[model samples]
Structure formats: structure tokens, C-alpha cells
Target: MKVQNIRMTATKKLIEEAFTDLLRKKGIEKITIKNITERAKINRATFYAHYEDKYQLFDEMIKGAATELINVHTKEENIWNQKQVTCLTQAVFEYLNQVKMSCPYSYQNLFPLLRMKMLNALKTHLESLFNSNNISEIKEFNILMYSRIIYDAAEVLVVEKTNLTYTEVIEEISEIILDNNQSF
Candidate 1:
């Protein structure tokens, strides 16, 4: 039973990776079931066995990446240290970087669906961590504000509009978060 689950998971990952590779090289509009099946070395029939269409595959890929990116930043219960936010920034950047690195033309393809959720989720993470701060408690407004800064910084990074390194961006935001300092 466990083996079957593992096998399924592996197959799913394979499909996502294959699709991502194709997307990286070309625009999403250019990808087809034949393309993915060819890349994954699976049968065309097997492709439909897993997903309804390319968009479905893309959503699964984004969601899986989203969960992973969210987990990297907000997964642990730390004191909102520089390291944790760094992880968050790195996770997000890494996701975008992968797309950009492999599929520069296609990276933006996921942004429309991915952007808002990423922003909101980052805000939630910031607020959650802020609420748990030992010295300063976070309010809703505070979280929203800090989250905007983080989102903007992250967006800049995603869009290649900023020169800040991922760690530097997180560090700068930490300062902003500290400035908004409140106690619980």
C-alpha cells in the first residue's frame, strides 16, 4: 500500500517536472500533451490519465510549489529570525528562479495565477510570526503593512526590478518589521 502511494507520488512529480521543463524552454501556450508525454517518456494516454490538460498540470505544479514555498518560510515555529525570513525569500526566489532559469519566456505564465496567493500567503506568515513575537505583538494592520513590503520586495525580485539579494531583502524587511514593533 505504501509502495503504491509512493509510486503515485513519483509519477505525479515526474509529470510536473516534465511539464516544467517544457514550460521553461517555451511559453505555456506552446506546451501540449504530446510535448509532456514525450519529455516524461510516458504514453500520451497516460498523460490524460493524470491531468485534464496542460493548465491542470500547471496548477498542480504551482500549488505544489506554493505549499513548499509556504512551508519553507512559515513551516517552523521560530522567533521570526532573519534566517526564517531568509528561508521564505529564498523559497520564493528559488521558485521564480527555477522558472526564469529554465523557462525565462514561460516564467511569467504562472504569475497571474500565482502572484496574489503568494502575496496573501506571505502576509499571513508575517502576521502569524508577528503575533507570536515575544517583545512586540503584531496587529492586523501591522501584518498587512509588513506583508505589503515583503510582497513588494518579493515582487521586485521576481520581476528583476530590484538589486537586493534574497537575504538582503529579507534583512531590510526585518528592519521594517522591527520598526513596526509592538508587544503582545
Candidate 2:
């Protein structure tokens, strides 16, 4: 069973790498399942067993990336604070910048979907932190609002090419969120 799991993991990695390669070379629209399977040297059945479609594969990849980014920037079990918030914003900006570099041609077309997925992932992470910290008073709406504010601020700083340096941007963001000394 362990060996089977290892093989499955290897096959999924192959599929993801193949898809990314195709995405870089020919963009998403031109990259079909057949193209992915051919590049990955896997059968259609194998591909289907792993992912229902290319879009699902893409989404899974994005979610995995988001999770990794969150883990790197915001430690698990940490309560919400100015540093954590800034780190989370940094993660979002870094992830989006990576997407831009990874698929320059498709970035514009994929931005909306990528933004939505990233926001959802960020919200999930925030909700986990909020829950673990016993912030029971915080509602789902508040979580969503906080996530949006963080995500949008990061987006503006990254995509808009603001005059402020990264450190300065994060400092301002931190001030904005932590100004009232409101407890998270």
C-alpha cells in the first residue's frame, strides 16, 4: 500500500510537471489532455484516475502552491498579528508574481481564476488560525472581509508597481490592520 501511494504521488508529479511545461510552451488553450498525457508518458485512464480534467489538475496545482506559500510565510498555530498579516500578504504577492512569471502568456486570462482560488485558500488558512485561536466571535463574513483586504492590498502593491518598497508596503499594511490595537 505504501508503494502504491508512492507510485501515485510520482505519477501525479509527472502529470503536473508535464502540464506546467505545456502551459509554458503553448499556453493553456492549446494544451489538451492528449498533449499532457503524451508529455507525461501516461495513459488517459491514468490521467483520469488522478484528475477528472486538466482544469482540476490546474486547480489542484494552484491550491498546493497556495498551501505551501501559506506554510512558508505564516506558521501554523500562530495567532493573527501584524507580523503574520504582513507575512500572509507577502505570500500572496509572491504567489501571484510566480504565476505571472510561470505563464506570462496566460497570466492575463488566468488572473481572475487565480485570484479567486488564492483568495479562497487564504480565507481557509485564516479561518483555521481564527478557529484555533478561539476567536469564536469572528463570523465568516469578517474572515472573508479580512482576507479580501489583505489580498487586495497585496495585489495593489504587486500588480500596480507602487513606489513603496516591499518592506514599506508591508509596514503600511500592518499599520492599517493593527492600527486600532484591535485584538484578533
* Highest-scoring model, lDDT: 2
Q: Residues 9-80, candidate 2, lDDT per residue (tens digit)?
A: 999999999999887776677789999999999999999999999889988888778778878988743878
Give the alpha carbon lDDT tens digit for every residue of 73-183 in model 1.
556646666666566666666666666677777777767667666767777666666666753645677667755666566667878667677667788876766644644
Where does candidate 1 have its weakest 10-residue lDDT segment? 175-184
Task: Name the runs in model 2 displaced over 4 angstroms.
Answer: 1-6, 131-137, 181-184
The TM-scores of all predictions, comma-separated, are 0.70, 0.79
lDDT for each candidate structure: 0.71, 0.83
> What's model 1's lDDT at 165?
78
